[model samples]
Target: MPDPIPATATPTLLYRCMTKGVKDAPESFEYGASWVTARRGMLSVHQDRLECGDWTIPYSAISQAVLFKTSQMLIPCYILKVRTATDSYQFGLSGNKFWSTDLPFPVTREKGRLRYSAFSIIARVILIAALIWYFYQAWA
Candidate 1:
């Protein structure tokens, strides 16, 4: 039903970070800002805190991203500034792990035929075990 990736190509996950922002902003952004997720090649922005709506931002759309840091008294503040073709977004987040790294990274490990990741499989098993333990405790 769908085209498969070429055998020569290996999918690599570079970096991921969570910020707060939205697109086509309103009168005030604080109220409209939501959790925005940034991955190696994409950014997922939820419209509201509940994730009622969303927008996907590809790395190509991003023209520039600036990282700023300032210390207040004894504390430090971090900010991520990203400029797209049509808009600018500032997110208050700590750490510059992504901003400091080189992009379009190559895959470090070989992948299995199945698409499921080892972490996802582990998480599922942990969740099931927790559920079972909860039920057993309730019954006992």
Candidate 2:
């Protein structure tokens, strides 16, 4: 028998690599863990040991999903790529059943590329300018 699923499991817990949208949104779940579950179909994500925000992705809004390998060295792992009309998100999943889902033939083709936003673009520009200034000062 499968181990019991915790009440805090993510929305994709039921269908590991689901491409099909449910007729209605799933139920909300909360746990005694540090993170708070504000609504259904949401996930708590952590960055740099700090909780950034909850991933409350509506089931009907998910246009596509992709499973890809992660860079973890200890073991071969995979994460789920969720794409909506306005945003794209990634989620660390526990199971390896993503390939079984009926994804597109090309799997949406959003992986392995640098996705830059306004902040990242500005950062890169600042970095380039700083490097040029440093070189000019050193030469002069």
Candidate 3:
């Protein structure tokens, strides 16, 4: 276990992420079409607060932190879910540093389940077929 970051220290970690949901969110926080489209942002972890876009959540307000996995475009995606007394926030993380010991709370990890939508499945099939044809033509 790593020591918790001090309040004055620089952010412990930063990740490229998409905000997926925000329950009981602030008025200025926009969550429109987040489920359908990517809302790219940066998630920064600090000793005191979690900053992402228009939201700044203090660790004291966080009731739970969970790390789980989902999929997008047939690719595995890691999700960080942070819950407060009255609010919950979900972020789809990018890059490899998905866990940190500097967090104020212990993050509960869940088993990953691959979920493929019809569109993604069809697209994957088409991509595989195209690759096979390309290889075959190249060999011929």
lDDT of 2 by residue, 1-140 (tens): 24434425654244322121222222211111211222224233211110113345554566765655443334544445566687655444343443345542224432232234555567678999999999999999
Quote the lDDT for 65 in model 3: 79
Q: What TM-score would each prediction reach against the true structure? A: 0.37, 0.34, 0.54
Better of 1 and 2 by TM-score: 1
**Which candidate has the highest lDDT of all?**
3
Task: Sort the predicted structures by TM-score, highest score first.
Answer: 3, 1, 2
For all candidates in order, the CA lDDT equals 0.42, 0.41, 0.60
The runs of at least 3 residues in candidate 2 whose Cα sits more than 4 Å from the true structure, single-residue gaps closed, are 1-53, 94-140
Error of 2 at 45 (Å): 14
Give the residue spans of candidate 1 off by over 4 A. 1-12, 22-53, 103-140
- C-alpha-based local distance difference test score of model 1: 0.42
Clashes of each: 0, 0, 0
**Candidate 1: tens digits of C-alpha lDDT, residues 1-140:** 12222323423333334445444432221322132332212232222111112444455666665545543344554444455688765554434444344434221221112123455566678899999999999999
lDDT of 3 by residue, 25-135 (tens): 232222233435544555667556788777777888888878775555666656677888878777766424445334455678765563555555676789999999999
Q: How many clashing pairs does model 3 include?
A: 0
